[model samples]
Target: MMLHPELLRAARTARRPLGLATVLLAAITLTHLAQAVLLAVVLSRIAHGDTAALAPLLLAVLAVVLIRAALGRAQRLTAVTAGATVRIRLRDTLLARLGGLGPTAITGARAGAVRATLVDGVEGVDAYVSRYLPQALITAAVPPLLLVAVALIEPYAALALGLALVLALFGPRWWDRLLARRGKEHWDSYEALAADYLEALQGMATLRAAGAVGRVRERLEKRSAALHRATVAKLRVSLVDTGLTDLAVQGGTAAAVLVACSSAATGRTAATGTYLLLMLASECFRPIRDLSREWHAGYLGVSAADGIAALRTAEPAVADRGTVDARWDTAPEIRFLNVHFTHPGADRPALDGVTFTAPAGRTTAIVGPSGAGKSTLLSLLLRQRDPYRGRVTVAGTATAAYSLASLRRGIAVVSQETYLFHATIAENLRIARPAATDGQLRAAARSA
Candidate 1:
């Protein structure tokens, strides 16, 4: 599956530290390979009564063991560092994009879906960075080195090992397309379930008041069932892919062993050489198997990346002007000049060529029955939505011309349904003017 170019680049860039880790891991792999070859040499020497090679060969095995442990630790550290960097950058980019888009774009978005993306989706990338990427490199690198080593001892075994690797890597690629399609469906179902459950909980009070809680619960259950089904289907596909990869590895090992044994029988290769080639051939497929397993885990990350990329690509609201002077203390006049607006999917305009003015230092209350576009007018004045036909002006300048921060600085709104924070009364009012003196607060309270 093709990754988004930006995400792929980010993943690649994160691995700069892993360059050294890669070299270290390769050294470890080679050390293990050397140990295997040495074991074969030691066995051959023992048969010839050469007691001198035994002690040094035993010491070499101990050194290889230590190096292998050190290499594992180094690779893990580097992989974690890389994964963390990628996650931070991905999250920052997602948040910046979401912020630029503002609340309107997210108005209809599900809380649970957003939570899943911000939490689970971002976290899921860890496996891809830590396990999948390094393993893929090791799988690609180690197998060839082992093939060369095996070729030196037993060329026939090497040729057989090469074919097995081809089967292991390309065989999964064929299934990857299918797995990716299923994975997308699985993630969609999971997100849908999350959204449904979140919506149910959010409206639980209303549902209970209307005696519809059972119905909502039933709906949630249905979504849960659907999610379960999708998950199981994806799991089944993964099992099939895993089974195929294992089959290839086992079959390849068997073929290599048989070829080596026949070469030894014909005196084309020594028995010790045959054993060495067989051992290295088996080791060669170890990284390949890890890579195949990583491929399965990567499906989740790939799916998440798709969701994140889509969110990042959404067009933001008109670009924000840089911060402007907060001159709203001057109480600038508000005017709407032949403004028009139509809500999406509405047959008629919500505000048709509407024009009004509120003079400075005057209290001009808007009174209209519900659905008379009063709130729409307020929203327009607040620059929550731009007009379709005309413009709103504050102090003779177009509202859009000023930064959003500047436009809202002048207004103090109190709705009939007051939203009180879970704080002291003074704290609630302090939101209006954070640094107001005690006397000023008392005067404002008296005015209220």
Candidate 2:
């Protein structure tokens, strides 16, 4: 699937730290490659009884080890910083999108799916940032360096290494289609199980009282079994990928060993060159292995990305037109002109051409039987949902002309099902009128 431009922008911005990490990683790789060549030279000198070469070779190896260790530390620090920044941006963006959706856009979404997306789905990205991203850099950088080193020692060995890399990268693309399908099924089953579990927990008392706990438990068990099957299917894909990578690594190493041995035995290449070829061949596979392991973890992240993208695509309840006049005090009065609305698939209209007017400083009470569209009227006034046909006006301007936030500021709503925050009563009431004095609060409560 094509990634959204906003998501791509966020991903790119979050990956800034990877640039520095890449440099350090490359330095480490080059130093290690140099150390391998030096070790091969030392071995050849030992065979010829040249002990003088051993001292410098030992020192070079020590220096390479130390540098590689330091580089590893720096890479870790950079990876963590990048992961944290990316995670924060992703979470903030998800929350902002959710906030913009309001109640209407989220009406059809499952709470369990949303919870999974916000909690587990977002957290899954850490693996991508910390493991997959850095490994991708190393795979891109280290492989070519190793191949070059191999080419200098044994050109045939270098050719084998290059083929191994192709098998490691593009070979996996062949299985991606299968993995993606299984991954989607796995995520779906997980979501279904989570939804069922939450529903059972919320209505535990009702289920028990009705003697239907057994049925609920049975259904949950079935969902669990389905999830297990999906998980196994996903694992099968991973095992196939692992097998392919291992085959490439082992086959390439054996080919390099044969080429090096043949060249050295025929006196066409020095012992040092043969040793360097073998070592570099092995080094070439490390990055490939790392990449494969990361791809195994990436399956879930790819699936989670689908969920996040879907959430981000949901349209906001109120559009930001950018020209909304916030000066409501001097604007024309709010008016509803024969507004009509019906929810999708509903048999009848909730508001059938309802007309109403509430001028500034005047209180209007809309009393009706339950299901007589009182709440629907309130929704229209709040601009939670636009009319199917007709227009709402605020201060002689269409409701669409006002900014969502600006239009909302001119009205306050109190419903029967009062939603209290997890705080003291004072705090909950303060949400409506933040600057209200304690005396004013008490008077308002008394009036209520």
Candidate 3:
């Protein structure tokens, strides 16, 4: 049930709310212990036929139960709030990072895989943040407290329960590697399937043209089957771990029960003491049980951690963070001086020692066959990428000197391929200049 470091780091962002939630869980655990003791006393009294003393004790038990219920509800609410805060903040950070990376960094990855990281991957951490993390604190704290209570009553019983707790906690470590490997495999399969489906959707027309739609569908079926197999393998490992945990829990409880019965039979402790030992022994394993359940529910967060880390660490194409003004007095001459660039992981440079100049206020057309570096030159001007060697300058000032926002604000681009949002024609046109008036939009439309 070890949490990934990335998940723990993200939890720090909502420490206050999560702290409150953990406190609530600890309070709830104390209530359960109190309830167990109260029930033991009530049962003992009933055995002694002390009907007259039952009223207040039963009322006290009722009050404790009600308090525990209220605390449980508050803990849930606080945990959910913390999860939401972390998810929103993390998503915002990832979005900013992706924006800085630009197309040059992301274009090499599958579109659906990127979308999964931004949406589903972010959501996957919610259970771990909200439930598992807070409960982990309870699991660590409550069992020791319970053991001390039992030890005060029956030292031998406490020792037996302690050994069981050790086994339950550490025995599962034996298979943790297998579980983690399966979890990663499952996430990889999911990403691959998502990417494949998205690619198929985007290229449906091309598939139909080539009469390969059926073949693509068959491939998607295979991908879906692979995902299913991975999921089953992960679940199989989880179920086995759960079985081992349960065996430890039940075996420890049984051992404690045997010790408690022996102490009572030999007249070492009274009925109340025996009852207390029994209840505390069962209660000792409660936190571990909750931890096991939460581990199953929130394991996806562990699997998604790598994806989140990858996006958070990816380097942006324009790392200079330009500061000089991109707004020139006039359309300044743009010069590419002995520029060289190569795409990531490519064997050869896209532009090798290329040099050119476009005069101010002059229309320049760069002609090239497919795969030539014409578009690469445009990309450099737009700061989508920097040149590997030499510099791209406007009026002798390097483009890297201007802030990204200011530089982009001063440039307007019309791409070779046009894309329109799901909006009216005017709305689509207004995307580039949101404040454009109807007359301006009409003029732009007419000119186009």
Candidate 4:
């Protein structure tokens, strides 16, 4: 009931599997109710000194138990599949979004923070998808179902059980506001610690060279301590909520059982009906208890709601579509006309009223000191970003008119710093042209 909307959206992508899992859970619950009735009947008959029904009733109970076990396993498998499907879909979406955003997406934050959002954040939704969400659906259906079954035997007992169910289900909402606040705090601390730790690892050499490793270590310890405190605070709220739920379950079950006992004492129902009502009453709160445990288990997903939402809602830097052809045999002149651009959160534009032309068949060298808009100008040509004002044209056509693939394929850049993948030189070279022949590879290497 307290599910995050973003997490619910992610689950919707795998609704088929989740729906199947829910059906399996419902089947499993029915089996439990069946076993309860059979055992109750068996116990009532045994008390009446009837041994004839023992063997067949016990066998029926065993059979129901076996069927329940099978259904439980199937439900677990379906739920797990749903969770994995959602994770994969979300990761694919995030990766594609990041790709469209290009390198500029990481400019505002450390690479580690992006990675944490992409990886750990998506992983956090698994429990909610696989366990808690499905269990919540079952909880909604099961308690009312048990109430109806008990109503058929004794309406007074059903009334008592239904009231208890309401108390158990709604009692935790009082603490929900507190838990949600603590959960957000915990996630913030966790993300900060993870980001800082990873950034420290990546910059360890620089820290050591500057003799600041000790300072970095101390800072990380402080962050770690903060994270620990946040975690304990969240856990404290969860423990209290859990205690309240347990108290409701116990109190609710006792109230229902007492009503059934009174019904039997008043001769409104026989021993068999009393036993059946008691057995059914015992199970009325089972789904609620399961849901309580699942909420605890899936708390990580709740905490990570913001991170997941951020990734899903990120906008691409530029559209990937274009209509103009970019298959010319010869290089075209590149021109920037009164261009303007700004980095997010910056005081001023990186480029303002910039105009330049690099004629075809001529080499153009753009040289500037650090923090200049030189790199920004080139990024516009690659469509890594669109100009805020004016146009970048190639061969008299605006660069935005050409598809990213064709435009990028027509240009080659030798960056100041080279990055090689963890592969052989040939493999890394082939990344740019996967079908390059051996002679073509040699030519490219020689050209480099």
Candidate 5:
């Protein structure tokens, strides 16, 4: 199965740890082979009624086992560390990009759906990095090495095992694209459910007042059912893929075992050789089985990776805001000079070569009919969005030169729609000026 391209790039961020884990996994596979060889020797010695070589063989087996255990522990630690590092870095990048998109772009988004993608979606990819990546490398490298060892003793057994290995790795290609499509559907369904559930929660009071809570509940249930169906469809493809892999593994082992038994019965291969052949054949398919199992385990994560990749590719609401001056403490004359601004995907300019000036120290009002871009004009003044063409200057200084934070500090707007913070009434009122006295707040409220 193919990993998402963005995920591969994210994985590169933790390359040092993943590389170390790969080496450790390779060592573990080698240790397992050594232990198997020791077992084969011990068994052959027992068949010959020789106990003299038993102690050394057993000691070697113990040593291999201990080494394998140590490698296993180290590999796990590395995997966890690498996975965490990748997740943290990717989440940070995702958040930063979202922030760069500005408030207008993000405000309409479903908070709960975005939260799910940011939290659960990021968490989901841990297995892909921790288990699937290291294991995949071992799966590719170890099987061939084992095949060679088997070939040295019994060529026919080796050939049979090699064919099965090829099929196990290649047979899933035809269905993999379809599985990816299903996986994507599952992820989208989950996001829809989260969005609907969160929207219902936030609008609970409104729903109750309107007596539409039951309707919303039914809609959420439908979304939940859709998610379940998508999950089941994806799982069906995964199970079938896993089953095919198991079939190849079992078939290859049986073929190898049959050849070994026939050679032993005809006296063409010694008991030690037959024993080694059986043990090595088992080793050969171990990686394939692991690859299949981990692929299934990490498949859902691939869907998450796709979501993150898609989000990263989206164009921001505005072009990069270049730079700005320090804080703005006092208002100044605001001028829009032949400004021509067009939003992304708009067919006409919102500003359309507009020229206007609001003199400082005076009350100025902009009146226009609905959809005449009055809000667009305010957005330009605040630098929440920038114009594609024209100059917006405050007190003869280009507004673009002033940092957005500094520019916004000196200007205030009572938006057409009020948005109260989820805090006490006093706290919400105090948001405009944290230092306002109780008397001052009461006076301002009365004035408004």
Candidate 6:
């Protein structure tokens, strides 16, 4: 299966652990082969009626079994660890990118859908990183090792197992492609359903008041149906893929078994060789079988990956980093010279050819009935946006010339709406001055 570039990029963050896990998987495969060999020898000894040597071989088998189990457990745990780490890093990057874009940029789209994608969508990628990815690496490494093991015991069986692997791994190229396509379609429908449902739920009251609830419900039902169909289609692909893998495994194993049994019956092979052939042949396809099953999990992850990648590539809003201090920090004069600006999707410039000056150390009031660009002037001075024509100057220097932080530090606004941090009272006030003391906080409160 093709992994999304974003997922591959994220894997680098947990590369060390995933690599260790993959290597561990190879070790587990070796241990499994060892266990099979030990058991085969013990069985051969019993077949020859050599019960006296059974005790030592039995103990050896037990030790190998225990070690294999432990390695399997460690491999699983490491895969989980690698998955979690990569997921956290990717989610954090997405968050930082979204934050950098600021409210103005995000406000252009559906907030509900964005929220769903940020949370549930990101959460969905863990299966790929933790399960499918490591297994894929293990599959590549394990099969060859298994092939060698079987060849040493019986060459014909190795041939059969190798042929089976070829069919299992590469025979379903078209099916895998279809699976990925179906997976993407499913996720798209699911995300749209979530976004629409959340938005509709939030505005249910308004819809009810306007007597449009029925229409909204109808649209939501249609979206739900689409999602159902998408899921069914994806599931169909998964079932067919699994069936094919099972068929290959059984057919391959049976052929290997027949060759081994015939050689033994004809005295060309020993009992131990026949036993090893059966055991190792079955084990050979185990990893490939696992890869087939994990394919669905990986495909689910691909769905969320697209949204995460989009957020990551969204051009970071122009850096707001303040490099130089504002020209004036206190009671600075504001001048807008032949300035022009237009809001998004607007028919005409809101402040075309606007010219105005507010003198320092004096209060100036902008009065307009409605939509007269009253707030626009304050926004320009705040450096929230830049003028399209001419310049907005503070204390005789263009506002853009100063760093965003330094320029904003020189201005303050009292808005009708208040935005507060989710923190303790003391911590919230600390935003105004990070080093403010308890006494300063009390005094500032009283003064306010």
Best by lDDT: 3
Q: How many clashes does each candidate structure show, in the order listed? A: 0, 1, 5, 0, 5, 0
In candidate 2, where is summed lDDT lowest over 10 consecutive residues? 1-10
- Residue-level lDDT of model 6, residues 95-183, one tens digit each, is 88886675556656577667766777666677777778878887887778889978887788888888888888777765867877887
Q: Estimate each model's TM-score.
A: 0.87, 0.88, 0.94, 0.93, 0.85, 0.87
Look at candidate 3 and tell me the lDDT of residue 127: 85
Residue pairs clashing, model 4 = none
Cα lDDT tens digits, model 4, 129-211, are 88999899999888897889899999988888877787788878888999999999998888888889899997898999999
* Model 1 Cα lDDT, one tens digit per residue, 301-333: 776777777777877545556355547657788
The list of candidate 2 runs beyond 4 A from truth reads: 1-8, 53-56, 203-212, 325-334, 359-363, 394-397, 421-448
lDDT of 2 by residue, 96-129 (tens): 9997888877887778878887777766675575
Candidate number with greatest TM-score:
3
For each candidate, the alpha-carbon lDDT, in order, equals 0.78, 0.78, 0.89, 0.87, 0.84, 0.81
Off by over 4 Å in 1: 1-6, 12-15, 18-24, 46-52, 321-326, 405-448
lDDT, model 3, position 104: 80
- Model 6 scores a TM of 0.87
The sequence of per-residue lDDT tens digits that candidate 3 reaches over residues 280-303 is: 899999999999998877788889
RMSD values for the candidates in order, in angstroms, are 3.6, 3.2, 2.1, 2.2, 4.4, 3.1
Clashing pairs in 6: none
Better of 1 and 5 by TM-score: 1
